[model samples]
Target: MITIIKNKTLKTLALCCALGVNFALSGCGAGDSVQAQSNPSTLATKDLSAFVNTFWYVPQAYTLAYSYSSSTNPKTTAVSDQTIWHFTSANGGYLLGCSFTSTNNGASWTSATIVGSVTANNTVSLGFFGGLVTVGSGILTSSSGQPAFLMQMSSGIASTGLTHWAYMLPITSSDPSWSSLPATNNVSVPTATASGC
Candidate 1:
């Protein structure tokens, strides 16, 4: 009788251990499932404008070869010039503008008209882990007959606010000087003469 009681007790303890192991394995699987569901790639689609608004433009100098026509003809002329960039606030609801200056043949045009308060819409798509910025459709017109549609791919870190952007413009008839300005490190406010519109 004593031997039978001991055997029953040992069997009951073994059964409880097996049950505990099963519960532990199932709990681990559930935790993995939760992690997979929380992946950033599965997040809802975000508006491009929302991403653009989060960054204010940091001024930099660029050397650009610009032309006015869509044709890559041998006759197309390229100019080296500079421009200043101004970006919108954190809602992508405003027009970010560039003030460009050009010197050609001893003649200088200062503050040449860039896009006038043109608002960018859903033009950006964020990448997984915020490693890239994909620009959708950007439409801006120059004072001359040059109309620009820009699509850019940029890479940067969100924590440092550093990014590199590349853009392509369809050919038109105006060849503008492309240059980069010295660091102004100043925020630009719209002047009254250009403000009433």
Candidate 2:
């Protein structure tokens, strides 16, 4: 579920969502952060070997929700949309293909796309239990070449089991804040729905 809110509210929601997922999976506190390391060569053999060519995505039912409303009326309306993600390996990295299906409570549907590439070396360390993290650039296929970004992570904990999460958002070509969006929106503890190239 995706909601449209004022800019401020949206930012708050994104942060809350990210922190919520982080804490739920690994007990990360408000101050805890996902540390990124670009040199994959320096990682341990186990860490490097953990990543495999697989397909995973956010289950439609678990998508983030969004709502809209009038400030004076105190009433809000929400629309739910489902996003499906596909990942493939390329050039020692990963290629991400995403499809956004807008549905009217499962009545109607509209699909959109965002394509991205995750370089092998552009990674984040989430500890041995958390697994590998991949970050890279993306583009909204429907837009006028609007640049975007993506982050993918695999995590496992005895309490919550295993899960895979991916996040993508639009960014200005020169946006210095691009790196922060993935970390901030890395919410949702959805397990990989399927596995394949």
Q: Which candidate is the best by lDDT?
A: 2
Global Cα lDDT for candidate 2: 0.32
- Runs of candidate 2 with Cα error greater than 4 angstroms are 1-40, 43-55, 69-76, 119-197
lDDT of 1 by residue, 3-31 (tens): 11112355654543455532322232211
The Cα error of candidate 1 at residue 168, in Å, is 13
lDDT of each: 0.30, 0.32
Candidate 1, run of 10 with poorest lDDT: 28-37
lDDT of 1 at 167: 34
- Which sections of candidate 1 miss by over 4 Å? 1-61, 68-74, 92-197
lDDT of 2 at 154: 27
Per-residue lDDT over 25-141 for candidate 2, one digit per residue giving the tens place of the 0 to 100 score: 222334333332234364332222222233233333344444433342434333343333433223333343433232243333333322333333343322121132222233222
List TM-scores for all candidates, in order. Answer: 0.26, 0.30
lDDT of 2 at 191: 17
